[model samples]
Structure formats: C-alpha cells, structure tokens
Target: MTTTADPPQPDDAGAPETDPPAPPAGAEDPATSFTRQRATRWLEPHLLLRMSLRAVVSAILGEYNDKRELMGEIEADGFLDLSTPDGDLWIDYVADLGDGFAATYAVATLLSRPELEVAPQGGTTHSTRQGRLLVLGGDECYPAAHVDEYENRLVGPYRAALPRKDPDAPCLQAVPGNHDWYDGLTAFMRTFCQGRWIGGWRSRQARSYFATKLSAGWWLWGVDIQFDTYLDEAQLSYFRRIAEELRPGDAVLLCTGKPSWVAATDDDVEAYATLDFFEREVIHPRHARVRLALTGDRHHYSRYGASDGAQKITAGGGGAFLSATHHLPETIHVPPPRSRARSKSRSTTYQRCDVYPEAGDSRRLSRGILRLPFATPTFAALLGGVYALLTLAVGAALRDPAHGLVEDVHAMAAALRGADVGRLAGGLADSVAAFLLCAVVIGGAVAFTRDASRRRGRITGLVHGLLHLTLLIVVIRGATWLTAGMPGTWSLALVVPLVFAVGGILAAELVALYLLVVDRLFGINSNELFAGQAIPDRRNFLRLRLQPDGTLTVYPIGVRRVPRDWDLRPGWVPGDRERFAPVDGIVAPFLIEEPIPIPRTAPGTAA
Candidate 1:
C-alpha cells in the first residue's frame, strides 16, 4: 500500500486552555477562596523561574533516587547478533504508551535504527522486506482512551514518526491496557480492528487478545486480561486451543499489561494471581515450553529470573514518568512461595539508563551515598503543616502582643529556665489543645470540598489540604529561621541559605502536587502514586528477537525525553513544551538482557 505525506494534525493552540470541564462553576466554595489563592501564588506560571527552581530541586533530591537499568543483561557483552536479515523474527514491543510526542520520537528512533529495519537485497527475492513487527503493549493514549486522543496522541504522532510506509508493511497489533477499557474499547476497536490505517501500519488481530504465529518453534501471546482482569472463559478457550494446536517443541512468549509482582503499597494479588493462573492453566497444562513473560505497567525496565526457570521482564517505559527502582518494595509472589526463594537477593541487573553519562551502579551509588530526607511530597506536607502552626504563633505574638500564643510560649520557656514547673505544665496543656483545634479546622476545610465523595475525592481533599497547609507553614517557618537573630549576630546570615533551601523544597512539592491534580486526578487516567504523594517519571519499552537458534534476546529501550528538532507543533498545548520537551535532554540507551537459550520440552510435557 502506498503511503501519503501525513495529513494535518490537531491544533490545540486555540482550544480551551482548561479542559475536563473545568471543575464546573460554583464547585470552588467561597470559603476555600483563600486556599485557592495561595495555591495560585505558588503554582502560577513563570516558566523560567519554575525551570530554574526545578533544576535546583532535582540537584538536591534527584540523587536520593537511583535505578538499575538492566543494560548489561540486555546488551550482553555486545554479542547482539544484530546482523539484520539473519532469517530470524524481529519484534519491537512497547507498553503503557501514547503520552505525548516523546513516544513518537521513540518510535521514530526505532524505525531509524539499522538493527530494527531491514535493508534491500538482504532478504527476499523482490528486495522488499522489513525485519520488524510493530507491537503495542497497551494504553494507546492518556487522559481517557478516546477517539480524539488516539488520533491526536497516537495516530498523528505515529504518522509523523514514520512518514513513509514500507512496501512490505509491518503488521500492527495491540493488547488493551486498563486505560483502553475505560471507554469500552470503542477507540481501540475503531482504530485497530476496523482495518483503519495508523500511519502505515495496521492491526491484524480480530480480538483484543491474540496469539500470533512466528518461527515454527516460537509463538507470541498478547492477552487482554482486561481491567483488573482474569482471562474470561472465551479468552481462556481461545488460548487453550492455540496451545493444543502447537507442536511439542513450540516455545511461548507471554505478554500482559501490568507487572506481576511489584510490591507496591497497594499490590494487586488478584492481578498477579490471574497471570499466574494463565501460566499454570492456559499454557503449562498444554505442555508448551515457557521462556519469558513480559509486562509494562511501571515505566521502567526490570528482569527477574526464578529458580523455577521462569523469567519476568518489565519494559513499561513507553512514554510515562520514570519509575523509581530504589523505592520499589520487594517483589511479592502470590501463595508466598512456600520454599526458600532467594529471588530478590539474586537480581543480575543494576545499571540505570536515564542520564547515561551519570548512569551505572558505581556512579549512582556514589552520588547517593547518603539519603536525602523530605525528598517526597508527604514529608513536605508534614513540614508544611508544622510551618503553618509556627507562623500562626508568630503572627499572634505580633498582632496581640499582650495576650499572644508566642508570648505564652516564651513565658513558658522562661519559666522552665527559672524552674516554674506549675506554669510550664499549664502552658503545655493549652498548647496541645490549640494544636488539636487547628487539626479540626483543617479537616473541616477538606471535608467541605464539593466533590469530596467522588472516587479518590476524599483522599485528594486530605492530601491537598495537608499539602497546602504544609506549603504555607514552610514559608512562614523558613522566614522565621532566616531572621531568628537580628543584625547584630551572624546567625541570620549563616541561616539564609538553609532558609532558601527550605523554600526551594516547598516550592518543588507545590509544583509536583499541582501537576498531579491537573495531569492525573482532574485530568484523565491516574498512575499508582505512593501515599498519593509523588509521581515517578520513567518512560520506556522493549525490543525482542527470537533467533532461529532458539536464543531469545531482549532490549529494554527508554525514552527520557524528546530528541532535538522533533516537531510537536501538530497538537500543541500550553504546557506541551515542559511536558514533552526538556532542555538538558538527558536520555539513556537500551538496557539489554543477556540472550537465553530456550530449553527443549519433552513431547506433551513441560520443559
């Protein structure tokens, strides 16, 4: 099929600056006006200042986090067998994708890479063969999985990424992620099922889940495992038949959307159990050799191998925020693995791909020798709330000097110095009561929000309230700290930098919270936030090849940001620059896994 120059793209320039219906009029109560105003002050736009401040914030706290990129395992001493047209199957897979133009940039980079694309005269008598298959892991678009988002975010960007179609076009296939199911798979079916062309590629699978025929001995299974899923009876039957149809030496590569065993604060045992079930019932029962299982929910790369001979690979880095490897809790296996499993202690990957020159175990470990406290927003919220109390105390001292809380506190301090035990005890009781009263007032404010009963509404209220409360307190306490001693002493001068540093941290937290509410809560889809505080920022994907010799090689590709000279003018938004484009433009390369030789299976028996 001939491909044309991509048509005009969506222009969000004139579209309403605000969307998702803008919280409806009267949603913001008049009583909360003060809090909203405070929010605006800290989060108001001044791009350069925000950038400068974020640079400082990252420098201070970024080191607190590090990742193991799994590069050596993927690269494996450079024995890539990358000589294309080797009469082998080439598959490029990505998941949780379609965030912005950066994903498109990643697609473009893959298409442009020599290893992924086949050259003329290398294969086929007609000299018209491409060595790659376009596989979508899931989540085609952000916000909701709607038609407009697919066209604007996915289709348009894809067309721009690879403008010309290969004469022998690569087939497109997608496994729907949770976001895709939000709209009942309407957009996904319309785009991928109806034979509609996305750029030059087309989806060939009739159902959401599909098992494709690759080399004679290799088969690929992409299951829907729909939202919070277990494979429905029909899906199970479909796969079971595929299993029955395969020969004895056939090997399987399983692909799903969410990671199986990430020990998140809210780990989904049922979800993992579902995958585990699919393995035991759908695949293992049929006696096919299982080589690798692939998933892409968290936006980073991880590879896990077990003593049971099962390997798990996560390559969610399609185009989302980076996932923090250090913060990820231990992997929790369902049924708790009754035996002594030393899986966690034996991970063979440690090199992270982001900020390449500064990547790798030794460098990152050296940079993050000591932990940085309060790097997360939860800590910021606590500090912010404390700062508020201190400010109220100081203000009361100034406004009503004769009968002020600060005066009472100072009197108590002096009494303690003079051994006035009774007076000190009374002052402490009064202070405790006042603190309780403040908590009640803040809780009332959170409860008063109009949408407090909606999904995550109450949590949002509490988190936001605490965050704002913390924001205010930080400013107040920081000011007080900077001026604790008047001009005569050098203490104030010495404390100035610390005060500014505190201010910077608070500023960073505010910025993070604002984006969280806008991008996730009020916007469209939401990621798993820890204590609803911080959003991880890793975007990545994977490239896999099953050679004729039965060696399976995996390459986990990460897209840190958009490369220089990419045109995002197609679907421009106000915050698009900051969202998709970054100045430092630090990006990591593919974290390769060492190739594994697939073990043969006995006839009608597990491998």
Candidate 2:
C-alpha cells in the first residue's frame, strides 16, 4: 500500500520539533474550569417535543419560502479561489458537530492547534499542520439551527477553543444540513453567509453552498441540498458558472451534507440521484473528474474507493451522538443501476476501504441500548407518566368513586386479584372515558414506531404498544398486591409512585428490546437505537494536503475519548495557544488508517 510518509522532524541543528507554545503564563486562571457538557440526549422528552414541533412548523413554512431560491438573488458572484503560495496547502474538514460542548470542544481544540503529531498504524509518528481552509461538511450545530443554539453549541465552543484572532487565520466555509434547515436556513445564513469571524477562522462564503478553486487544477465544491431535496435552479446555475473555469482533466473535490452513496446502497436512490444529476449536468460537461467526494452526516468515518482511485468518504464524527457503523454497506455502486440512463457518468463499484470504531466495536457498542432507562432518563420518565395515567384510569373504571380513597383501593385490588375478565370487560365498557384513555395509550405505542412508514414498521409499532399495555396491567396488579397490608392512604402513595417509577423503566426496556429486535430482523431504527445511547467517543475529522505535484494526501484522525473537564484561561488575547485546556491534558489524535494518497490522474479518467 502507498503512504504519505512524514518528513524528518528535526531542525538543521538537530533540535527536536514541537508544537507552538502553550498559553502565556500571564494569562489568568479563572476560579472555575468550564464544565463539560455531554452529547445531546435525543430521546429526552422535552427536546423531542420541541424538535418535532420545529420540524413540522419548518416544513409548513418552507413551502412558502424556499431559502435556496432566495439565496440566488443575494449570492455574491464568482467562486472562492485559493492560491498555493508555498506550493502546498492543507485543509481541515469536519461535520455533524455542535451537539454538546465536551465533544465539540474536544474536536475544536484539536483543530485549533497549530500542529498535531499523530502516530499512524505501522508508520513513524508525524506532525500535521492545521489547514489553511476549514470546511464544515454539514450539521454545524445540532438539535436545531437558532441564533442562541449556534452561539452556545457551535460558535461558543469554537471560539473558546481558538479564542483569539490571527493574522493568517483559516478561511471557513459550510454546507447546511437538515438541522441547519430547521430554521429554514435563517440561522445558517447568519452564521456563515456574512463573511464574519467564527473563532480564529474567518467565514468567506456568501451562500449556503460554495465552490472553491484550490491550487492550480483542483476544486472543492460544497453543495447545499436542502433536506435532501433537489438541486435548486439557482444553486445549479451558480455551479454552472463555476464550471466555466474548469479545464479538461482538472480534478474536483465534492462535499455534500449527506452520504448519498450510503443511502443508495440502502435502496434509497433519490438522494444519490440528485448528486448524480449535478455531476452529469455541471461537472462532467467541463470534462473534469470528481476525484473525491466527502460528507459528514453519518457521524462516523467510512470510505468507499472506486476502481479508478476516486473516493467517497463519510467523516461526520465531529461531535453529536455517535451513530452505529455496523449497518453500513460493504460496497456500493455509484449512479446505482436504476439512475444510469439519466446521466453520462460511467458506473463504478466502490468498495468500503476503512471504517472508524471497526464493525466489531460498533456491534459491541450497540448493546448499550439495553441500558435505555439510564441512557435516556427523560424518555423513561415519560413512559412512567403514561403508566400512571393508565393505572388511574383502571382504578376509576373498577372502583366506586363515591367511596373513600382506602375503600376504593381495596375494591380495585379485589377486582384485579379476582382476574374476572368478564367483570373487567363490563367495567371498561361502562366507563367511556377510561376506555378512550386505553385506546389512546395503545394508539400512541403503535404510532411511536420509528419505521412506521412501512408495513413492517407499523406491525412492529403495534407489537410494542401491546407490550406496554400488558406491562401496565401487570404493574398495576403487582403494585396493589404489594401495598395490600399498608396503612390508610399509604398504599395510595406507594402505588402511584411505584407505578410511575418502576413501570416507566419496564416500559423503556420494552422500547430498547423493540429497537434491538427490529434492527436484527429488518435492519431498521438504527438511528433510534444508538441515539438513545448517546455515545460521546469515537469522534473524527479529516486533514487533506494538496502537494504541488498534484498528489492529495488524506489524514483520517480519530479521538477515542473526549475530555470531560477543561481549565479556563482568562485574560487571554489573540495569538494565545488556547483559551481552555483539557483537564486530563489534550487527547493525542491517531490516524484511523494510513494517509490515503489519490493521484491527479487515475484509471478511467478524462485523460
């Protein structure tokens, strides 16, 4: 295998090389360290409701205001162009970050460093300098895109990491993801479109999408495919103009928000189809080859290299909750068989080359789903509340409300212990309100299925709902029996809390079991499965070097664990090493694999 070996690491006088100096001693140490935050607990009750509401409102509002179309009217002319004054250049790329502080800052801290010495497998240690250009692949901030969310989650962490201005700061550019589209690109535009400063990095792009000319014959194209929608007319026209600058045999680096190649492998062809159409209509017409495609929506690192040495990589592990990699396809055919006739792009089979966390580790981490209650306490609490309501409804249906509380409990317990199905049915039939409540609970369970859009998903959801209903009946009966000998009003107190606490856990476990079953049987709900676990480790990013000889070397960096505590640097000023330092010391990054080298010309190219 070819490798980009690190050059010798010594000055002419034989002095050992080192990264730039740490923050100056004059910098003050605040009374407290910045408390690190965890990855977004997506299964949390309040967050879920809020996100769902935003998604719905955004969808409805988006119909009237297409941000991409509006972008055309305001976009600046000409593509972003970069020169290689030193005959070589470095670029940093990360995506799917800004969910939590600790993980996001961990990655940011690394990126902000002037240089990193990484120990690659089977190779000598080497120092890689920071990129001159920083490309945020997508999903810059998580949960949703809002002014406050961007500041706290995305900008704040980055500002804290770098925390100072520089004369030669890297240029920042981005492509919007679904989360950024939650606010209909309002927050995204504010953050990236203004050519402002985000930390020491300066934003240069004036639109959600960008095309950059890197070096003599290489280009970086960042497309904004809003919510996996079509290539809007305005965006396409912009790229078409950029295409005019392309020369035959030139190479392009395509950056997109989603790994449409992976989606195509999963039988979702439309996503890749959009990308295919863009390449066929825009890039190919110029006779330029897309040497590599990069993306970051999957929250892990996966690379698929075609026979011609062209590569597609997904490096989403900037932050956010770690997504499972066990389910990724081993190989995929670009332009998938169905969409071939629509484009002149030739078909190529790309095989999965390297993956972070390894498939075995991914499978092992998945078992974390079994700890659902602890992983997502709010979710369990929501279930507990549901169970409490169901129990009260059962009590009202079986016992006389006119009686005292203790007497009612005794009567309800007696009816439940008797296991008299006919009497139970008669009581339920007589109480219209109680019956309706039961119907709603069951209906909710069925509706909660992640894959509810498909028949199997509906069936799985119905099974999950019935399982919760059964657990409710068992918990009510068990709780009443346990409190049988308690004093007056004591059983009432013990029973409700027990149902709420214990019942909630049991119901959540059922959800975990449901996720496991569905994933194993039908290959669905993997997102929900790992989102509940919210693993904070296994984050990664890419550093690419463009040599004057037209050779591109890619370094895949991985962080197995992010620091949880940070020491704040007060009174820090520009040119300072960093504003906050990790308490456990900065985690040294390692190469997930050897640096991949893609030549300017590969097999079956325009040349």
Question: What TM-score would each prediction reach against the true structure?
Answer: 0.55, 0.89
Q: For candidate 1, lDDT tens digit of each residue in 422-515?
A: 4322332245443564565457435433341355656655666556545544454445444555431243233334434564456445544443
Once fitted onto the true fold, the runs of candidate 2 whose alpha carbons sit more than 4 angstroms away are: 1-37, 339-346, 400-410, 420-431, 487-490, 569-574, 604-607
TM-score of 2: 0.89
Clashes of 1: 19
Candidate 1: lDDT over CA atoms? Answer: 0.47
Best by lDDT: 2
Instruction: Name the lDDT value of residue 452 in candidate 2.
Output: 28
